[model samples]
Target: MNRILIDSSVHHMRIAVVENGKLVELHWESKAHQSIVGNIYAGRVENVVKGMQAAFVDIGQEKNAYLYYGQERATTDSNPKEGRKLKMGDTVLVQVTKDAVGEKGAVVTEELSFPGRFLVLLPEDTREIGISKKITDTEERNRIKEVLKDSLPEGYSAIVRTNGAKKSKEEYQKELDVLLKNCQAIQQFGQYAKPPALLLQEKSPALRIARELYASEVDEIVVNDRSIYEELLQAGEFPQEDGVTLLHYQDNTPIFEAYFVESQAEKALEQRVWLKSGGFLMIQQTEACVVIDVNTGKFTGKKSVEKTILKTNLEAASEIAAQLRLRNLSGIIIVDFIDMVSKEHRHLVQEALEQAVRKDRNKTVVVGMTELGLMQITRKKTRPSLEQQMSVSCRYCNGTGRYPSIDWTVSKMRREIESIFSNTIYQKVIVTANPKVLDAFCGKEEVFLKELQHKFEKTIVCIPMQAMAFDKYHIEKQKDS
Candidate 1:
């Protein structure tokens, strides 16, 4: 059974999508760090970079937002000023399409959209009606298209979400009315709002996920926080006939710990994943793309060599898809599966991967295998990955994941001490270094310390700071006793 577990009693609101007993997707939001995607903003153009065909707009954020006008023709809407050229200090209503990652600013666009429970309202879109590609049944698609065609206001368009296929016409019209009202309010507010003002904020991450992901497969929606649970109830988010049970968790134990999601979440952050077959996968996220290496560890199959390698690759194909969603690893992905000489075997592995990724909410495309036996895939990235959201770079290694060698650290410390002594006139010096570094610097029986004092013609005292970083130290002149 699939479950949507929400732990919102804590400062950080966490929501996990569990398939059977395994965690497939995890999402979290805090007040200090909130997603701005789908938010409408009245922004002021700060600079127009003609060379890049893009303009930087101040949207009341630390980093100015990036707006590319090169695709204006493609995004032409019903507004009279839709494709107008932007200049410095121009006020334009825009919506954030992508959140800020690292040093980059949020990517905003003139084409704004408002997402509802069953449809996404596009106020300016000329297209009358659109349906989700997931609703492959031609009869159902036509049914929804016809219902929306008559109910929708002229010039406005909407895309029916995946869950909309199961809803009745009355439900569609109800949601459409709400979305249209919101669109009108945003437009009215944006007209009078000053530059760099917020026109409309999107729904909270928890509600957004519940609204979009509570499809036919999800059986139960469990939330620990009473307030969010009540809000969901009041909003009529779940249908009574859908057989979806909404439960308010009243257990004393934390929701995540009770559900065994805490341990699984920690495992998701790990670099290596062990499969049920005893084979392993090493997933590494780099600046450009994610690289997954499949290894046949302890699982030496009873069959022939070809069969053993093929079995591991097939298992890896499924796990890679699950891991990509669990970790929210997006953008370019290259999977190095165990190579098989047979063309048919390779075909099997690729088909398995494609089938697994079909369940993903994000658009993931398996771009086929390369000449080097590497399988290439791409997932649309709009926000930071799980790793980037949950952790920061190591301070000691400066994100390199490697520290300076002990010998190298000692040598560098000696040079720094020499330079300090040469530049200052203090006779007595005190040095504080990491405990391990101090042991190496002091040498056997304090021989290195004595030699340093003798060479510099000054008194030296070496103090060991256990809390200090591996390669970090402090030096200061000692006061007269």
Candidate 2:
């Protein structure tokens, strides 16, 4: 059964999707992060960089937002700021196209989109009309297009969402009207409102995902929080679907923990993943790209060496796709598969990776293999990855996962002592560092410490502090030894 479980009682809201009794997707949103993508705002252009063809807009936030000139301009005539350079004080209607990731601000666009249950209203332009690519039936697509012509606002266009395929004209009209009214409200508010004001707030994360991803084929939606449960009921259209049920889970245990999702989520954060065939994937995420190395851990095929290598690469390719989606790893990716001599084997692995990636909702491109036999895949990135959102950089290693060694620390300490003696006059220099660094520096017989004192021609005291942090130390001045 395809089921969705939403837990909102905690500081962050979590949504878990289980398909055929296996956890396939998990999304987390913190309540404090009010700036979600797709929200409409009345922004003022703060600055324009002509070289980059981009503008920084103020959207009533701490950091100024950014937007490209051709953010969503499909055609030249569709450009709202047509043939005119946006100045520092020009007002424009914008929407959050991408969430703020890392030190970057949210990305906004002049193109406005108001999404409803079965349609996304693109106001001020009625030139474009289409149906979802998922609705492949030609007849149904024509029917949807005809219905859109009638129900859509005069100066607006829309894409009939997949859920609208089987709906009657009246149903489509109702949703279209709601979206039109919302768009109108946003326009009215943007006219007189102050710059950088929010015109329309996006729906809650749970409802937004439900409407976009789970509108069809979802058997049940179970929410743990009572308020969110009631809010879903207030919408009053989801539960009306055939055989679809809305459940309020009031059990003592959290919804995610009870459904074995917590365990799966924990595994997703791991760097190494073991496949069923006993081969493993070592996944490392860097700033520029994600790298996955395939290793034949314990899997040995019954056939020749070529067969074993092919089997391992095929298995690794499939798992790489799953982990990318499950962990929400976006941007450029590089996969180093076990080298195969045959060209046919390489093609089979690439095809398997592409097939596995088809199930992902995000946009991905397989750029084929590089000269070094590494497969390159690029995925769209809006917000930070799941690991980045949930985890913080380490204090000592700064997220590199490797701290400086004792010998390096000792070297750094001596540099500090030398610099201190050259700059400041003191009778004795007291070096206070962590026990590990002190042990490595002074040694058991204080050989290094005595040599340092003799060289400096000043009393030097080594103080081992168990409570001190490894990466930090204090070189303080002392009048007496």
Candidate 3:
């Protein structure tokens, strides 16, 4: 049984998932006044590239929004147009599909779907009947599909969620009618509302999760906020007495700490994750993909070499799965597992990895291992990972783990002095820097600095400061007497 608890505050929103009374997953999202999700806009199609079948739309933002032709619904009002059909001044209704990232604008789509408790209403595609793949029962799927087929309107579609499984036909029918009514209301509102307006706002994250993920498998839903708990109870979706407990935490101690979730969350942020077998995995992420390297740290197996390698790889498989869920890592992932000798051992290790990842909620596919001992895997990415959300690049290392060399700093200082001499009328200049930086300026680079002083006809003095940072420096110009 798994329990979920949400802590929503003004600055940060945190969610903890406990399985078998132990914390398994913890997620936090910071609301720093820069949210770009679920924003609807009236965009002007700026440019339509015929070859790419895409257009760049200006949505009154710094960067242009992207719209793809395939994302647009097949409508009856569309003319079979060719050669740049969309013009510059054309106004279109667009919904943001992807948020604006580094150097890229928001990805918008013409076809929009509003998500309800147990259904996603697609206003454009009516005949399309879909169900969540997570529900494996064929009879339940067919039952839900039949209910959706009867209630759906022309030129609209409703995707039944996983929660619809095992629900009675009467219950499903009732929910479908309620959802269809809401969709109709939204459509009517959209017709009367002004352009660049939001017709339907998505539910809050907590409510959204409950609608999407809450099922018989969930043991309890604990929330720190009383108002949100009351709202969930009022919705009447989650039953109180059927082992689905909704707890309102009022303790002075933080709810996350009570569950030991904060410690697990801190471990997820680290680059090196240690395994119980004394082996470790170092993970580094870039814009392209995440790279994981396996290492045999303190593990000195007294067994044969082949056995040692197999044990390390086996340990890595489980840790890799846990790290993926803990960090919310997604997209292309390359794992460099410790090389094993036996083919059977390799196959067993891969199978172990597949079994370990079965617990994750997100869909993951292991594409098999390569000859170079690298295992390739892909996880569905919905948003930015935990690291990108919580951390920034180091100022000193600039994320490369290398700083400016002493010689480079000395040369840069000389250039600054020369620039000041050519521009200003200072008589003496005092340069203060760390011991290493000052030593480079006075030791091997002393001749260069002296030549610059002679050319400028200005007195220059080097002052070494031990307390200064590696990158810290100061230049002071002495007034003429």
Candidate 4:
């Protein structure tokens, strides 16, 4: 039976589902000052950039929203003489596709989808009846398709989720009717609602999980929030089981720790994941891709070297798939398995990994192993990864994972002194930074400080601030007498 746990902390929220003894799905949502994405907006087109084939939109935010020309659907009713043209001051119904990161504005699209418990409702296009690829049973797929065909409006299409695989046609129709009503309400509201208005908002994380993740196998849904618990009870039909329970955690310890999930969560964030067979996986995530290296940490099998490596690689294959799902890591992923001598061993390890990832709800494609003993795979990215949502780039190394050398620090200090002396306004300057930078400059690079005094003709003082980052320093100009 599966168990769903929600950690609804004010700073960050995490949801984890455990099936049997393995972690299946985990998601983290950050509550930083940044606006949440997927929010529908009533936006005004500020400027139409014909050169870029896009427009800058004002969505009542600091940075203007970005709308690409490709996001606009081609209409057959467009004027033949005028062609497609969007001018300034035009009001558009837009939904945020991507969150604003760094300097880039939020990416907006007119194509919007509302997620329901059993199906995803697409209002604009609906002729096709789609089912999740995870549902491999042809008979179950046909059953869901028949339910959708009979229940949905003429213009709407429904993608039957994997959760609806074994459900009766009557049961599937009931869920579809709820979604259809919800969509109709949203459309009616959108007609009279002010521009830059929210026509629909997704349900809370707990309800969403119950709808999307809960199946007949789920033993219990535990929640700490009393209000949300009551809401879930009234929201939909929960799966029935003999021992199934809805638990309300009222302990002093956090809900995650009470369930012994905190330690597992902490382990998920670490760089190394160790298997019982003494093999380990070293995971490193970069902006471009995630790299995983398999190693035989300590296990020397009671067999030949080839057997040991193959055994370790096979074990790492299953663990790699588990970690990918638990962390929700996406984009290009390259896994370096311990090199094997046998062709059969390689094929077995590859098949093992592919079979494990096939159970994932999101689409995953295992492109097999490369000649360099690497396995390449990709998973559809629906949201920012757990790491991206919870952590920021380090300030000290500026994400390079290394601090500046003593010589580099001294050289930068000398340049700063020279620039400060040329100004001629400061009587003294205080340099403050981490102990390493200070120790490097004051201990090994003291000669450069002396030479800078001779060159710049100014008194420079360096004081280490223990609170400063390793590569960060503050400079303050003193008042001249």
Give the per-residue lDDT digits (tens) of candidate 2, residues 1-481.
8888886732367677788777777776766464378888888999998655689999988788998874333445443444347889989888997888767888988878888777888876645786877788998888777776767667887877777777888988888878888888889989998887888888888888777666547889999888888888898658555667899997544466667666686576688999899999998888788988999999988999999999999989888888888788889999999998899999999999999988787888888999889999998886667676665556666677634444434655665565565556676888889988787678668887877677667888777889986667788888666
Candidate 4 lowest-lDDT run of ten? 402-411
Taking all chains together, each candidate's TM-score versus the true structure is 0.80, 0.80, 0.74, 0.72
TM-score, prediction 1: 0.80
Off by over 4 Å in 4: 32-38, 44-90, 96-109, 166-174, 188-195, 237-244, 402-481
Question: CA shift at 294, candidate 3, in angstroms?
Answer: 1.2
**Candidate 2 similarity to native, TM-score:** 0.80
- Give the clashing pairs for model 1: none
Give a tens-digit lDDT track for model 3, residues 235-278. Answer: 77777645588889865345665666656765767799898889
Q: Ranking under lDDT, best-scoring first?
A: 1, 2, 3, 4
Q: Give the number of colliding residue pairs in candidate 2.
A: 0
Poorest stretch of ten by lDDT in candidate 2: 71-80
Clash counts per candidate, in order, are 0, 0, 1, 2
Count of backbone collisions within predicted model 4: 2
